[model samples]
Target chain A: MASTDTFTDIRGCPSGARPLHRPRRRVPREPPASSFPTRSGDFGTGARTRTGTGARLRNPAERARRQWAVSGWAGLSVVCRPGVGGMAQSRGMTSIKATSGGESAVRVRGLVKHYGSTKALDGVDLDVRQGTVLGVLGPNGAGKTTLVRVLSTLVQPDAGTAMVAGYDVLTQPRQLRRVIGLTGQYASVDEKLSGRENLYMIGRLLDLSRKDARRRAEEMLERFSLTEAAKRPAAQYSGGMRRRLDLAASMVGHPAVLYLDEPTTGLDPRTRNEVWREVRRMVGDGSTVLLTTQYMEEAEQLADELTVVDRGRVIAEGRVDELKARIGGRTLRIRPTDGHRPAEMAEALAASPVTGVGGATADVEDGTVTVPIVDDDQLTAVVRLLAERGFGIAEIGTSLPSLDEVFLAVTGQKASVPQDPRPAADNSDDLEGAAV
Target chain B: MSTATITPPAAVRGARSEGRIGLRANLRHISALVRRNALQIKQDPESMFDALLMPIIFTLLFVYVFGGAISGKGHQAAYVNYVVPGLMAMMGMNIAQAVGTGINDDFKKGVMDRFRTMPIARSSVLIAKIVVEIGRMLVATAILLGMGFALGMTVHTDVLHLLAAVVLSLVFGASLMWIFILLGLTMKTAQSVQGVAMLVLMPLQFGSSIFAPTTTMPGWLQSFTDVNPLSNLADASRALVNGGAVAHSVWMTLAWAIGITAVTAPLAVMRFRKKA
Candidate 1:
């Protein structure tokens, strides 16, 4: 059974918290970010010292330290650094690692596969630790399905190698099949047979006797809440029910390693959440899973590590926030309250790293200026410098970097396939400008 | 319902999950598959209709409508005796091809993929399907024989010869199944399998001596009947059930059985494995 605490923690943020910045660079009397989950602010030492209400007025960083300490999995480290221009950027890289160790559940290196003239997989590498979820994210026709097929031993790679549950995929596929369970994007349950019969058949195929297979089938039906529908043919079941049955079929063997290919592709949001909960429960029980999906939010919510693939190759891989932070950091927008010269606003930002470098553009229009900041301290330095210049700040809010932006930052463009050669080159130049 | 989660039974957990479980286990797996497919046919009204109704309908229509015209007046019993064995062989071939069509449909539907990913023997699927088809053939043939008995057409040969005829026809039909299996793996859909089966198997049935003796056919058609395996199966059946020279036809049919398996079996299995 899955603990409710993991689901509550998984709701952290689609994009994580904004790293608060204090320009003075003072280490507080006590260290922050060593405890429990915090909601008020980043684990900034004495950053939110004022302006908050009574309860929030207490040390927000101290609360964060307590929450993280109790969680025992997520490592929330706050590192503030000053750049070459003497502008401080306070950044928090929050990485969620699973609580299991030792041998990897899945490991692949330089796998190459080809079909006629089409290269479905070309030199792809992945590592999924024991008892963790590794989300493989890619768009349609991006070789995500092909990679899953190769790793699951359904299709042999033309080159390189893969190891699933300590068995070589190419030479020991039968052994690999014994330890691993695979649920394809399409449900593979028998349509004419009742759901109970379908599960019973799979159980028997996996070498269970008649009585044991029947017993296991009943357990699975009840666990998935399909007890009443167990006797009905799978053809009559809804899409979600069929998917649950397919997933249930894979679990009947008690597989140590499981593979799910776009598991919730056609499900509604509610059904998709239920599937997510089941996956979390499986992970909580110490089973390793490698899931391929196109949903960015699903990856953010469930995956401890993510591998973003595009065009048969891995483009980016890391924890969610690390990947987000790798792309130009969050966007910081400031609308000045007092009207000022465009030159003065640009001059004030010029002293820091946001002087139109690293994809940050400062637009001075009608006494207001907006600049993109790739670092937390850049925001702090800009805030301090603007106050020093006697420029009243009207509105200031930081936009957290999303997966779409991270995808764009790494791949340089979206998943569209273009045919124009000259225009593609021109678009690539603009892509470099847009990507930090 | 208090957390009765899935647990691998001790009987299975103690052994290697994908180990070869011996001939008994393979037979058990194959029987499970055959039983499931048998259930599928039992539940499907279309399959039930084809199994029980079509044989009786075809028997009566041919023995009554074509009987008088082909055998002349007062010779209907002789025609019935001849047509019974011929229709039995034809029905076996027809049903075997339909099994191939089912295999093709399952391929398109991802059923084959589901079986392939499991930790069981790969041949269990094709083997189980063949068993179900042979079972259907036996049931259909038995009904046809019973209808013949009702029509006052008794077998001239003894029980030993009649048994040989039934077994020989079954072997020949199983051999022809290899061809449709190859075609099923090659074709795209069940409809295409039917189209190709008609184009290929129907000509072999009609152009041969299934309806009338090949000795009375055109010179060119006689050449095809001489070589057609359907002609061999029909001739072997007529000799055993109707009492005639059986040695030459039996050898020729056995040769066709070996020749078809030698050619088509490898091609079908190669295609299945190459897809992996």
Candidate 2:
């Protein structure tokens, strides 16, 4: 369970300060960020500060300092003094430092975003420790994209606050922008520009010198294995190549925090694995990544933490194994060849808690009986009972709890794509007429 | 790894020099947009052919067909002098749809969304679109002006006057970009921009004194035409080409141009930010 203190802190109303004589003050706790149940291995290691309101009122710089101190992961010291003259130099950025020293790369408190009347993000709070991958798993329209947008500075939040890379998102957006890279779901490259030109354009946008932009563009083309096709216009590029180029273009400035919003939505397994390898490479180089995915196996494979969001709120969060363990029971499958009786097969599977009793002769194409046992120990009993019934078994296996089942269990909706308001034609004639 | 411990002086200096490079990046983005527009022109020359060809065709057809009735000049005579300036002003106004339609297409195609995530300057995308508009305007000007010259339209003004006229036309052309940018943000469809912008611009061209002198129009229409920026622009262009006195209308035309740009630029930018 999430801490009561974290929830109260997010409310900004001190729990103990409520007046007994006054009317009831209704304060809604901010929704926790989409993430899995975090292990308590390091929670109390950090301090949460409360700066004085007077200090916040004096100077904007002091206010940023207060927010930073209040919000930043505890062990690191971040000082903000007035005067633009020495501010950049005083940050001590002589050499690039890894963000892994007991500091959260991202922190949000009571962040809320509303699109008209629809609350896209219903007050999201998050803490991402440095250099780890936090995968946001949610069905479509679960506010994953909205959360990423706010943290990335693409969208403004209605309420609450967030800090990225020790910079307050609202107060220090320009600085925050420099330290983060965002790759949205759609390809953003200019179709008229060549792949090389597209990367070069982004490099230029990130403030690289002309020579450096060219150099970076060349490097990215090679890194994404797009060097051969670099001179061709992006309009002619394949879907997978375009996605690779899009990801490559986002890396022009070597941002510290990378946000990949449903990065592999339209990719094939091989191409998806290629993107996964690049993400792994980035994380290996000490870049903190926030990825939103609908793929369960993807979260299990790459994420250090998983957060499941449903209907704009986080329903469950934790490491993948912890989520799997919480599913409580595993289903065991039994395949018996030429079963003596269907009753014997049903009885074997019904020995444990008996949550369900199901078997089908057609479950095995070759005239055999199959049953599902929902307990680990029940599997042995099934084997013994089958032998006692003088029935030979063909094969048996256990199916572990899957993320699909978890999603259905939590959201009460089968994981499927929501119907978009706009419908595009099939374009069968165009597809057939296009050059391969 | 090779055991070379030496660091080049360039490398050492480069590491220490922390100069601001955002301006250069923005300049590069603008140049890239120009190149991209050039490539688009290359791929679909027919699409841009209309911007250049339409103005010339309109000059030829309108001058030959309507110049005799409107200005009492025969088609074979000096009708080119009467219609060329109008054609030039109309060319700028005609290409306003290209900016709005192109921007609307880009918005619909998710191009703007893509640009938002890019490390480039946020203003550069719109700036690039405006730069492309300037090119289209110049192309249209060249085509119409060349057609007029080919048809024995003599310039009584000196080279300086001609240059000033061209510069004024281009300034007016650039100012026209803000309205299109704002329209592009307001309208969801590229085709709707064509339908709506034409409805607004066609009257501004025909209802004004572009085709004929304001003296030829009715009294109520003449007053409206006098205040029309298009009329002032056409009058200014005519005075420059005819080597007449630098008219008071040039100042009014410039004022309108500056005023529209001032009001619309901020609104366009704000709308763009909201859309993104």
Candidate 3:
């Protein structure tokens, strides 16, 4: 499960330090008063302090204090600083380390591929360090699969260049293929062949001797938990079983780099977790992975870094935590007790110096007041203010923005729902891109 | 799933630094794919329906229904000898079309992507399919000849000549496969491949001397049959099995086989390379 808490101190803070405020009496619901905008304004400025450079200059110590608050968080230390150029420079430095290190497993530059008039990959660039998963996060028709295909040498790029495991995708495709394994979105296995046969055949094609191929097939079956169904035709296997078999087939060569293009796109949660575990095991065994997925949770769970692509371009690239922080820090949610109007709580918090300046706003539908908190002190301030005002608090928790929220904030459009019925068009675009 | 501790296999460890697959490895890969195709056929017997049933139905229908009219009313037995060898050519044409549909289906299944990504000869994938289809053609030929022998169709020539005719049909069948394989590599779907194959097969089957002598046809039709590779194969097999002039048709069949293969094999390979 993805951890909702982004702030380590807040999650581990003692509850006794911030007493819970229980409602003594019910308050009538009233139409929000005209004072709501003024309250929202006070909190909005406090929220803007982290993003506004003028506010940072007003208090030189404020930057150092906020840095201490976020420094403990992985991948968020440098990014949390409040300058566009500084953040951009830090991101560049990280990628430079990723690309320049001798451990870079796959490097791509200006990989442009056009299918008819549609540019499937328009000047795409990427760098994945060795033994780490670089999750290519994208929605459908975003050219994530095209990038995988080009890097795997299954499709030739019209222009640009890519090197996987030190071999050029175009000039050294044959040698590149010897070191990379690709598992396509669809389970590309021989449906009529038994699971064992599929793995054995791949093994033999990889230049293994007959005896070694058999041994490798058996070993893979056991490792992937497909030993029980080794003799059954893959066509008879369930969806998850076939996916496991397909994954096992790719692993037969023990490739140095594995490209999994949406490996768990439609799998149930249990099977998805199983796939995640298998990926972790592979990475543990020193195989670098380039995983493409639309599920933000999958990326957050497995990727060391993520490259968010939209319409054949990289919109954002960073570690998962860094991407979340790029949008904003943690949000505090305060739910009022039953019949206690949330608007009143928002009004009260808006007048206070601490909670009032942090952009607290009431959502009537959820009956909660949300505040964007820059530090743990704001949360404690809100709790103390609510208790002093005798307002009943039903629930209180601070959570980092979900990746879904980050995706929306960065792309300016909602990520397509996983179960959206528009897959037909998306799939045709994918097939066209692949077929070319 | 339990974390089953697994050490990487020796083959995988040793293969990490391996270069492009050599000729020996290519042959091995082709043979493995051939075994895979054979296994798939065994598992799904329906895939062999055309090969197994087409020969039987065509042999019986052509020998009994058209035998009387084509060989003269009272000498149907002569038609059996004439039609049975010609059916070999028909079987070859029909089964070769199946190669196209089979390859098209493989492409749709996305397994071709898996093969393309592997460190193996690209031609091995197509060669294995052709090898299996040729095996299927041979099976259909045996069934056709078995039905012919049961119907009082005699090989008037020696057994060596009969063997030579069977070998000739296999060669012609194998060569014809490249054309269909090219179709498979280029067509958008299996149904389109089948539809276009039927259009090609119809003219080559009916316009040739398979069911009736080309000498009695119209002038224009005779010219087509004379140049038709299927016609050459039928005429050569007929001469070898029933004892007739063999040189012209046999040499023509070999030349057509060589020409079709020479023209189509490279095209098919090039198409396969570019398809993805």
Candidate 4:
């Protein structure tokens, strides 16, 4: 049966196709109290209740739209509103697009897969709206790659369902494969073929005409800045170049949805930024992206909404700012003068009326005393109390919690580098060794 | 880069129908994959070393080492005509084994994942590998025929008969590949695929009539050779080129080809689908 159930255009075009240079339209904002549920109900109650409601909806598209509406509104109201923070204001434009009720490009619910005795994906649920990136953040062996593999139809899930771009991953894999592109964790380019040949081969396999395939190959090679090495074998290319080629190969078909499984895992900062730029450009061109990464910076730089997964389950899901905010608002870091000890300062701050009754705890680490402050009043009160106590502050600053801190708060464990027993033989040794 | 100016083609933008790949598109996909595998061989010429060298070494060793012993003192030239056609069967079996190793190596690399995720028909990948290996087998047969001629062996029948003999070997060779392809898909690594293939190939190669006539063998061994597909292939090619009663052996070889393919092709596809 020809099912168009998942076919919803982001631009609201009835035909599901849009012109290349059409003027961009502002996302239609839904009222906070109408379509969206309470923010705390969606994110604060943990992954189980949220996933339970999502699973109860029989239609995956309906479930995806509902979940997207909830998370999208939460992300927008928390980050896009004016006067929130300089960081949120700077990112407000992207979050606005993220909040649109665009069709879900990928809808996965109650996904479960087991490899032998280990559960690779334990009842995971995710939704990615058109023209936005949903970052699946997890540590190694956290089922990130398995989720990507299952959604891309490379691996079948043991149970549950996934629908991508109007095609069910299990029943309609061929149709799903037509609209989705996957750049796996390992670069999947043909090593023996030249860069140009690799792209051309993929173009042809994607059902492009021979002339179009050749033209698309040239266009992708030029776009990725691989024209200089177009004729060289991919095996001879550097790690970054091979990754670019793999990305280019996946893009030759201009798939409506792209899955990037750790696209910049071992890349240097320069290459990582290049990948991020490519991802943004694709999103700007009206393609939905589901990016899986272990790097917080990568997720922060690309994902409009983040889904934190660990040990085969979704631990937390929201905007990056919301996740950080959930841990607790900005932290007040105080470094006392060289003569005073941070431990004594922390003890005094903890005992003071300003911080004691509010339940904001103060802790000392590496010569700095940090207090989690909920508002500007707490910040001012702490500063006044410190001055009244005759404390000499050498350095003081208020900073938002890093993703590392948020990860620790949620997973209750640091996102440590996974213990890979193999030597770093795959790529450039510079950043890979540092990453390990 | 400004991808804003670049849009996907109209075919991609439109509502994609739930269409199965037609025969024409499947043929195109198979040809494209075949070109890819052929290009790999072109880039790494050493991959074809066995196909080129094995026939030459085997032809010389069998002709000189066992010619007089097997065919009697003054009849070495007769043995040349006898063993050369039989060696064609051997060439087919050896070249077919490479298909399994090549597929296992692709599985080890990330390229297999790419193939699996593409919208093309899954059988296209295996068919392309078989096509390229069959091409390699033809090349080895040509080299074996040339070596046989250089060693003073002559074809008694017309070139049509000699060509038929070569085609028969390839038909049998292509069918044998599905078995090895199954081994490649099920085995963990290329080394293990080779190890298991060798274990299966040794007895089949020795017990068959590819090296000597089955008439001189023990009764029980002859009974085994009566049913061995390799022996049927060797006997068929011997009759086709040396001008003998060709109907029985030729029909038996074709039947074995159909039977092996019928059993193994579906099994290989099932294994390929479940491999990940």
Candidate 5:
């Protein structure tokens, strides 16, 4: 389906099939945006099955169990992205009260922007509450940056309107600029200036008096822990320090709404935590935040509400735990002491109570059987039956669904690896120190 | 949840306090922007080198290489007196190009986004850019004229006429600045800005009566050179400094300055608004 979407451009171009023989120029080498090779199942065999690492859909009962994952709804786990069919054209300001039941600090309605033929943003509607963090999560080219740019008044939207901090982005941009601060993906400070000088420059640009600007510069330096290196040029600062300074520069004006676009993309774990701590402190000060991130862990750590966006639309949105539950239930992993999983479901099903739970499905890989059970009682039943059936249990643990699993279940694509986005570790000093 | 007013920090509180800024406060912001850009240039020695070195190199090449031929052979003073005004006009245009490429760099690095979100006057950035260009022109003019004096370029008019010549060059530079702003905001890259500078400014500088008077050129070339704003600016400066009749060129230069500005200022601002 993903390949056929591009058939006309390559084969039917004015140059014809000759271009097909050449390597595709614009095809991203990294299997970008929405490409998942091993997600589909066999249509030839009558029984449905999902094919991936450790997934075996041979038996009829086993295939039926995996069918539970095949959406009772749109069911786009294997191939297509969510919201390709269900995206609403407009959810005007009235939808805010209906959806969130409160006034949002930032409200977006049917925001659409296209770059050439690619729709970078397609009718995206979202709401971030006052004094709360809304994490916008998506893969590469998912319009996360576009949404941030629109809200921050940096990039104009081709269609629809966005209201940030009670000011319309189009008509009241100057007022909105006063009420919001933006920290983009790249740090935009003057490399020639010292950290203290950079903050002072921003303070003055914000129209603070000389005395106030000087005091604010000192205050920000202390806040970001850059006092030791405050006199050094920002070009010489470490990646973490520079990121902190970029964040600190944005907070100089005390913006009511702050837009952080992938704030911790290249930071080490410790530095990322430092940035997270500052964000928490800002929220404590009653500032609403719109944070965009690739790491589900970061979203889980920071976002009060999560909006999982894929291909320019929100696919799933809820608290982390709620999103996990909606996508899939908690999973149970048990490893037998005899160094083997019970190969056949028949032995455990007829003699034991493992099949009692309606939607429970188990896949045994590497001598560990992982079961997605509906609730705790079913978990207890599965545990008791595993030992009772003489499957000597070496390890027994219940693992709640993580945001990573939720992302995969909803988007159908594996989460891109977060650490070390670049091969050369030259600009950022602490990539090796990234632990969280 | 119901909530009370959230306390803002010092800078934001200042922005909220400003209902309508008076002219004095607006000037303050304009001056602040000018000062910030001055500091940026001060820190960048390469900018200083370009400002000081480029004018001297061009002046020496024109005066030494063409001074003998433009005048009779080995006649330095006549050509020096004749060509300094033209070099100053070129200096003004180069300073204008600096504004163009500098603004382009600001846009590419996303620094313009930071400034657009500030509560200061929107016109202050443009005003500061013009002010900085004038400053560069003055410095480059001083260096170029000092070299001209050493090579025996004499000032026939009093200090008042000389100061007026300086003012005239600045006005023309400011006019070119509005056009540069349009070019800077419209183009996507700094390299494109340079490309435009070569295309538009190179002909304006070299095709005018800087090295030779209009009579020396062919009839077809003379037609375009007659109305070229650079020609009028160079002619006005020449008449004021070298003791020629000043009426015709001075009025033409002022008209070009005002006309170019009237046409380009709003257009540049509109383009900048769209780009922002």
Candidate 6:
């Protein structure tokens, strides 16, 4: 049965085929006063299964375990729920209370930021709960990093209200700083200091007693697997090690809210997984993480609820799976036997309930015909229909929607590796010792 | 979990004392920074060698080589006496670059950013750097005086003149430091700070009377050198060391220090805030 609850673009744009690709360029109206808060809230509002690469539907048992994990933590309140289904027309602030009664980790109302004449955040209102990870997924120039910087108190917004851990960003920034940690795209660790000393220095600044600071430093050193090299200066460490140390340093304060801006922009797959594990560990310990990344796989694997921002405005947001489901549940694929047989394969596949007739002969050169299947059962019916029509089918496959597809569909843009050029080192030593 | 929830008088006192924690925290940070840099220097004494050795070498070179040529006919004026004071002032100015380089190194290493994100006193980082520089300038001064005495550069004045000359030179050194500190903060690249400092210091020193009397220069150059801060500092220092009249140059030296401080301090603070 087709659910009429399916959201269609009000302007009659086709769903699941053509994505709402036009860039949102206008400034949004002001959010309502009720939505403003002095700071952000806690995390862990909800959870579900962690999908593995194996071709299996979500198991009932896994869902129950996830539900348990989400609820067992002490409850923290969510300030606002993301507007569902349709595009947000008004800039009105929406007050949302989390499942837990605790204060929100972040509260923002009509937070608009601009760079010169170009607007980076066109009046965005976001309420991230405490102890949970909120993954910010966006195409290039989506203002994800800008929003993170503003909330982290590194950059000031041109207009609107924001609070982190209950401290006003503008008025009570110093107090707010005590309760948060920020990691930038590049590692912000001091390469000259030993890994242990870096953590200890941060701990000392956070008002930890000497004994407590040393203890915390030791704990972090072991946690990030740097204990063996903790005494060695960070300059000798590898790129991944430095990145890990940067994240570990931010955790020295045990900040209530952590802002990670593209934490893994340049890392090998193995290192990326290690970082993902570390993030999970942090969330499990009840720390709220707000991370921005260009890697869709990272977002799909880690985000509890993802927000897709484009050109400074939120275009879509939902649980990762739900978002994928909205943009066509599955894709059916097939291959033809010969390089020139695309027309023959398209004819046979089109007869078997496929929606579109599109492909080059080279796509079918491997003897394949691909189709988008709504249900797995359709695969069996398609194969039988192909056989009945005396069409030779060499290969067929079905796959779920990917983050890249969702990104392309929603923003009408393909995902590319993010460009973040590190500045070149210059020679000269007069005051050279002054720069770090 | 609470039994009658009563507040203690001691708790109130503790809360009151907490207000001063910010100051204490900053002091702690300053001490930590100084200790860290000092330890680095202790482990590698070669870094401090330049400060101690460079002044002595330059003083000798100036007194013997250029001193006689500028003193001219040498009938009355002692060239060694004339060169000592100017060399002492020049030594202080040269050592001031050490302060800028120290701060610049910390900034380039991401140490300053780490400090910024911390809850430590905001101004303590720069203050610690200045403290380190003052200590370095003292060492340089000692080397310079030792070399000058060996070269027959005698001071005709008493202890007060020696003390005042050293103090004035240190003040002038600090004034130069303020200008460079501003440079270090404004120029993001360490190389840029080095380039700009060399560009300013070399010309200023060359144009001053550290190596020769400004009266010996050409018409336009003489007037420019006469008003130069370096010349004023050298002349005042020479008067103090030789027991000569403490003329208007003394006030001029003090005025230059005060003037530069007044203008550069605010600009430095602004740049520091912007970068932070």
The residue-level lDDT of candidate 3 at A106 comes to 91
Better of 1 and 2 by DockQ: 1
Q: Name the candidate that leads on DockQ.
A: 4
lDDT of 1 at A73: 35
* Residue-by-residue lDDT tens digits, candidate 1, B157-223: 8889988988888888888888888888888888898998999877888987788888888888899
Candidate 2 residue-pair clash tally: 8
Per-residue CA lDDT of candidate 3, range A1-436, in tens? 2111112111112212211221121111122222211222233321111222212222234334334443433322122332222123233213434433235689888889889988889878788866567889988998999999899887799888898878898888888887888887643999899999999999888777788789889999998999999999998998788888888998888788999999998899889888877776676465678999998878766776678787787766765555555555656677788877989888878887883344788988767788876665665678888899899986665444556766665565754322212222323343343334
Model 4 per-residue lDDT at B36: 95
Docking category for candidate 1? Answer: acceptable
**Lowest summed lDDT over 10 consecutive residues: which window, candidate 2 chain A?**
A86-95
TM-score, cand. 4:
0.79
Q: Deviation in angstroms for B90 in model 5?
A: 1.3
Candidate 2 lDDT (Cα, whole model)?
Answer: 0.64
Instruction: Give the lDDT of residue B195 in candidate 2.
Output: 87
Evaluate model 4 with DockQ and give the value: 0.37
What is the interface root-mean-square deviation of candidate 2? Answer: 9.4
> Candidate 6: misplaced stretches above 4 Å?
A1-102, A139-141, A330-400, A414-436, B1-21, B36-53, B72-81, B98-109, B158-163, B218-223, B245-252
Interface CA RMSD, all predictions: 6.4, 9.4, 7.2, 2.8, 8.1, 8.8
Worst 10 residues of 5 chain B by lDDT: B1-10
The number of clashing residue pairs in each candidate reads 14, 8, 2, 0, 1, 44
lDDT-best of 2 and 3: 3
Off by over 4 Å in 3: A2-89, A92-102, A333-350, A355-357, A361-369, A375-398, A414-436, B1-18
lDDT by residue for model 5 (A255-334), tens? 88898999999889889888877776665455678999988877766676678777776666654444544555445555
Q: What is the C-alpha lDDT of each candidate?
A: 0.68, 0.64, 0.74, 0.74, 0.68, 0.63
True contacts kept of 6: 0.18
Give every collision pair in model 2.
A35-A307, A35-A317, A36-A306, A36-A317, A36-A318, A37-A317, A37-A318, A205-B120
